[model samples]
Target: MAILWKIDPAHSEIQFKVKHLMITTVTGYFRTFNLEVETETEDFHTAKRIEFTADIDSIDTNNDQRDTHLKSADFFDSANHDQLRFVGGKYESHGDEAKLHGDLTIRGITKPITLDVEFMGTVVDPYGQYKAGFTVKGKIKRKEFNLTWDAVTEAGSVVVSDDVRLMAEVQLIKQG
Candidate 1:
């Protein structure tokens, strides 16, 4: 039988950073998301499956106008494709350092991506619940997923950079 683990939403966060006008980077978070993992044992290296999804409508960047635009057709088009998803594949690990390869789907396009993961160790909580933590980081090009909205200033600076950095601080609770 496989062991099941689910993200503790209250203690997890998914964020992305992107450059604006080649100047400053803007950070955004998906306020609502879910992640589940199945393993043969408590060891995450033994994971058999991993799945994650985030609600695009929950995107927050601290600016209402920009947030609204991000949900529009020009960006995530939350009206159509309401979620961002990731299905995990090969998991390579060496001690606390690891690499998770997976297929990431955005705007209906799926692409292979690899994320660097740091296993933050497992512990028994005060409530006696088994918990695990991980820090994950990766990068993706917006245009690759058809998020190709473009704009330029008179001075010739692009509105948004193609590269987007992804980072997640995740905590999972082991289930019986």
Candidate 2:
């Protein structure tokens, strides 16, 4: 029998970046996120599920004012939408690369998002726990999901890019 796994929150990271002022960039990370990975199947070719949920208020950009702004109504509206989630989908591994199909919800809008997943392989820890690593990267247009708030600069460049870059490192634990 194969062993499935749960996420080790302490070892996982969730982050995102977006163009700021059209010349600079802004990056932020969520200190809190949860994940569950199904790894019991020896046949990795088959559908394996990845479920994730992130706390919106945990966003950290190292700038208090900016962080507060991000949680305001102009952005995530954290008070109204306290979380961002991606729910179950299949995954296929080819060589070191994989593809994940799931629903990404932000600002209360749920949309289908496909992430380019790279399997960093798996190993057993010194403590004898099985672990898997993955690096995920994807891009989404804020406007497409109704996150259309923006400001134009004097040169006509928007303050925030329509496209946002999301990346994360997931650490999975194995079920005995």
Candidate 3:
């Protein structure tokens, strides 16, 4: 039988960094979201599957006003694009590391992406449950998703860069 698990919010983080003001970069993340994964691993031949989804409206950079502005029509437009989803992807392990591929959808745009993943191994938690952890990181241009909001600086440079870096550390609990 295969095993399934859900992401523990208290153990996961989703964040992004974008160049701002033509000199520095700003980072932010969502305070709430969930993901579920399934696996049939009893041996090397059996690989795991993962599905990730997120809520755009929950974004926070520690400022409520800025968060509200991000939800407006200029950025996420959360009312029209409430959810961002990733179709579960598979990775073949190579010496303790893996490369995961999937389609990431955001703001009505979907693009194929590849994430360099590392299996951080699993353990039996103090709570008496088995858990697995993974780290996934990748970069995608916001313009590809039509999220091209930006500003011009007096020095002839753009206020915000086009490339956005996505980084996440996720923990999946083992299901019986």
Best by lDDT: 1
In candidate 2, how many Å is residue 95 off? 1.6
Residue by residue across 73-154, what tens digits does model 3's lDDT show? 7788899999788875667678667877788898989989988777788889999888888887889898888787877867
The TM-scores of all predictions, comma-separated, are: 0.99, 0.91, 0.92
Better of 2 and 3 by lDDT: 2
Model 2 Cα lDDT, one tens digit per residue, 50-165: 67888989999999998898888888889999998898686766788988888989888999988998988888899998788889999988887667788887888889899899
lDDT for residue 170 in candidate 1, whole number 0-100: 100
lDDT of 1 by residue, 32-115 (tens): 999999999999899999999999999999999999999999999999999999999999999999999999999999999999
| Number of backbone clashes in candidate 1 | 0
Worst lDDT 10-window in candidate 1? 39-48
Pairs of residues at least 3 apart in sequence or in different chains that clash in candidate 3? none
Better of 1 and 2 by TM-score: 1
How far does residue 110 in candidate 3 sit from its true spot (Å)? 1.0
